[model samples]
Target: MNIPDPQTFTDPEKLRKLMANAVRLGYEDLAFNCKLRIAEIAGAAQDDVIEREFWTALIAAEEFKAAAAGKTSRLAKIRTKHRRVGAQRLLADMMMEEAVSDGFETLVAHGRAELTCEAIVLRHEDQFSVDAVNAARKKLMDHGVAMTDIAA
Candidate 1:
């Protein structure tokens, strides 16, 4: 049900896709949340820190691109900065995924209900093979858990 807007290219355009993904998922809120979380992770405890982190990443990205393509123009620099910020955000998402996975395991073990995140749903759908299901059941024999009531 979630669809995002068409992507727009910028100087570096690294975060463009992520921003678009957020828009598509109707996750403007998530986008905002990520931005704040990213800021915190990058040591941006204040407004200036956030700006500094963003600019520093931007500068590094631009430099990297310039070295890669032999183009050291101002445009390339700007593009590099944005691209770098986007990359940082993308990597942070991985950490978030690990957290989600650990949380899901904990909740399920405790027989507690938890909010379903999109990644978990997608992963479950992807990993739910009949053979895989049987394998898991066999693996859990010592834990006294059975996969009989699993919902496909």
Candidate 2:
């Protein structure tokens, strides 16, 4: 049996294989949607290769958030703060990219609440307060999506 290398996060083929392995291990719902999202970004022009790494890290950050929200009390609290910090760092790094910045703006203008909320937070990290992000979210919800949807 060939074990996949663990340091291949930015490689599309390796990431796809890892995601497939996750589904085979009974994580289909979680892995499949993420895979599709990644695939969307991966299909972009070759010069847009940076999207793959950024999106992958973004997905990992989301997973960390989900894990932190687990029902098991002890497990939920264990290192959750650290995990959250890690997730935030990952997102902050992603926000530095031009494509992610543009995509985030588009998401806030047209994407679903879940994604918009994340984009808002990513776009206004240390410069904004939690309440500020909340206020932006509320504004977006009130305005409703009216922007052109950008294909991934």
TM-score of every prediction relative to native: 0.21, 0.27
Candidate 2: give the clashing pairs: none
What digit string (tens of lDDT, one per residue) describes model 1 on residues 1-152? Answer: 65433222222343434544675777765443333333233333325422444333334333333433545523443345446664234223322332333322332343321111212222243434444433334433333433432321
Stretches of candidate 1 exceeding 4 Å from the true structure? 1-47, 73-152
lDDT tens digits, residue span 38-122, model 2:
4344434234233333344334334433433542122232135336654344444333333333333433432333343344343
- Write down the lDDT of every candidate, Cα atoms only: 0.36, 0.42
**Global lDDT for candidate 2?**
0.42
Please tell me which predicted candidate would have the highest lDDT against the true structure: 2
Each model's backbone clash number: 6, 0
